[model samples]
Target: MVNFKGIGEIIKILNMNYSKKNYAIDVSGRGKATPPPLQHLLDPINKIVHSQRCATVTLPCILKAPLPKNYKVRWSKVEPAEYMEVVILITNGAHHKTYGPLGSRVRLRHSHRYDASLTISNVALEDEGRYRCQLINGLEDESLTLVLELDGVVFPYQTNYGRYKFNYFEAKQACQRQDSRLATYGQLYKAWTEGLDWCNAGWVMEGTVHYPIINSREPCGGRLLLPGVRSYGAKNKSKDRFDAFCFSSAVKGRVYFIRGHLNFKEAIQACQKDRATIAKVGQLYAAWKFSKLDHCDGGWLEDGSVRYPIITPRTGCGGLPDPGVRSFGFPSKLRKKYGVYCFSVK
Candidate 1:
């Protein structure tokens, strides 16, 4: 459990106003900076912090100095390739301020006077990325970078355009539309270890197409290769076409079926009538995995595709013996009628 004795200290720190005119500190300039073990702080050997969704995660920043004053600790989310960053918080010993979405959920751990660590609550998928914690004290400014990874589930995704129809960019956009992101090789491997068996190759984060196989089959890879993730190697992001393995974490909302014989437009209206919205593909997957949502009847998802989650497989339910989401591909928007899955963010 996190120590909350410093609540008054946190309120006191964040309440103090330290405007730019009074506390103008440049964190970008690292001229001739010595490699860490910074003189003021020390970081962990492995800077990767892993946690689950909706959990609190701490990015450690141990201070070596004795409650140093006139020094500000700045935390920012570093973008890929270091091209951009969004500030999360900044505190100059007394004054503190927060910024951006992450900032709204972040606070200084402040377990002790010497602890300058940052804690983020209600962690979400968007918070998975690189973050930098910097200590600015005149020319002695130094920083440390940490990567936040969430343990989650991975599923293969494809659009109505059919298999092998999406390029890298389009595949990513499709995953985002479904409330997920392109799964990295590590995430895919983790899913494979937990019994993810698929025959079709899909796009991973490294711009490669691969598929996880648990059973050796004649149709998939000729049964010659052992049961593992078969790879197609790296391909052109713009030219190569394939399905995608999307990664998603836990859901904070409820996904339920709104029984109705409705088209795509009607499905949308049905969800809106319930004061909710159509459930995204990823949200449905999360609900099935985390909440054990099981339904035999096919329902319209947000992407105009009909699907159903079956936790206890039986006869006549998609006619298969797998406990997973059964998809019917993308059907006609105006002609098809099905029950709609609505997501209520409560």
Candidate 2:
């Protein structure tokens, strides 16, 4: 029979052999020399390194790993199965594989066993969603999920700017919502003269209009008018033609009408309240096309010191002289009381 010390020596040798072999062995207390305790030996070995033995994968875009390498990474829309290609670059040398809705393109770089990297570019809104990486080694495999988000670009006029017609105030609100403003005079002029009006009508910036502050004058006002022209008329015959204003820029020119319907006295008061003055002949001419004046009523001409009516040979009514034929202040009764519309440039 084996002695106590002899049996102990045999067990120690068996234990040492098991350690070097990287295997589990069991021993029994009986003289029969039973197989080493398989389960007991394996418990500690499994606990120490089972998880670490498997290959680990990482995505620069992902926080965890065991992702696949050297495989086609497919990217698709979350809601729809449409395939998309996203550009991805791997930073680490570890072999990895990408799969399922990976976007447009996949680029891989070799990395260390534990190190990895990934990147995507030219991302689109639909490209946003979940992405996954799968990794495989001879004996073990792992996988991880990553989320991709793509930002969208929004252009102006996509909102109500195209659908509705907004006055100055309403237009301003619309622009603000779209992160833009109404077109400016410069913009409007550019659009019109440069033929960009074919593009759209509301180019002016918010709170901007050809007719803000009611009565205002244009700079280089008189220069825009046609030579030998004294007056202008409206398009509608039955309706009294209001004074028209013209604005010219290096890019283009536009004509706008002052809101009409006020008598001469009322017009003067309106201009005063708005800090403006009555429209002048040259300004009116600049806005009115003589070819288009068939229905418009001519405007009043004022040279600062005097006012004259454009109506030729003003018919005498109840002994009142014709104001049209006479020079400044000829029609005494029509002097200051003459009804007229005005504009301001400020």
Candidate 3:
């Protein structure tokens, strides 16, 4: 049943190739960088690394060849939509230089002689994307691509215009305005696993519209249908309209509730008295998901809407069986009275 002899022979051949400097290994296993010739290559099947927000992650990139004395190892992030590459850092074994916002949080992990990996500290949601590690040696260059995925919570977003008013482009802009991005299918699935149930369909990534159904009532879909994420397939990006499912990661600041009977203007003043600003929708969701923030009183958010986080669902709190950030919609700026949620940026 075992083929140890064949496996050993293959390893031996690979080692011989490495010794001869005729091969190379890109972490993605998609093959070696061309033109300048490869020395020793080892391609791993799976290279994607999943990490949570604010957690440290190391993107592996080992070059097995006998590197030149003056070669440089550079790391850059590739934007998913535009394929725009931003250099994070560059090093030549001893001296290193960092660049851009990401550069301040990233450094090369030179643990071993062959290691040319990158270590990112305090990872943020904008850090999710493709990263490229390139080995440059004069006329020869070998590079590998690694994907960084963040584990976070997803929330349905809609404008004041009401439900299903945002087209694909508008939905993307709305999420961005809320300090979030359109959630990916995998991110939505993860949210569903953590008990996300919404009736309205929303735009996810890739021009796809999807919704999660936990209770499965008639208005949502049907009582008989099984509980899962429902999809409307790919829709017209310009014509079809839907809400947006935005994904937000852990926040550095803390969101707290300051109980008071205040309107929109007074609510802002209340937070200012406490030396903090009104919390945004994305910050509230991040606090609820990561810190388990629970409050019963409706609080005025920065967007003029009233909402509250409910980690433990109860009868008096919106009377809903699910645990989520309950919303009271956009209340009157002058008449409706509520508390305020303040965010302190430390």
- Between which residue pairs do clashes occur in model 3? 23-39, 23-40, 23-41, 24-40, 24-41, 25-41, 25-42
In candidate 2, where is summed lDDT lowest over 10 consecutive residues? 45-54
Per-candidate RMSD, Å = 9.6, 32.2, 8.9
Residue 278 CA displacement from its true place in model 3, Å: 0.4
lDDT of candidate 2 over 178-295, digit per residue (tens): 2223443433443334322121223233122232211122331244542221222112222321211122111012222234444455555666776666654333332232212111
lDDT digits (tens) for residues 1-26 of candidate 1: 11223434322222222332133222
Clash counts for all predictions: 0, 55, 7
Model 3 lDDT per residue over 102-144, tens place: 8899887889878888999999888887777777776556566
- Where is the poorest 10-residue window by lDDT in model 3? 1-10
Q: Indicate which candidate wins on TM-score.
A: 3
Instruction: Give the clashing residue pairs of candidate 1, or none.
Output: none
* lDDT sort, best first: 1, 3, 2
TM-score, every prediction: 0.78, 0.20, 0.79
C-alpha local distance difference test of each model:
0.81, 0.31, 0.81
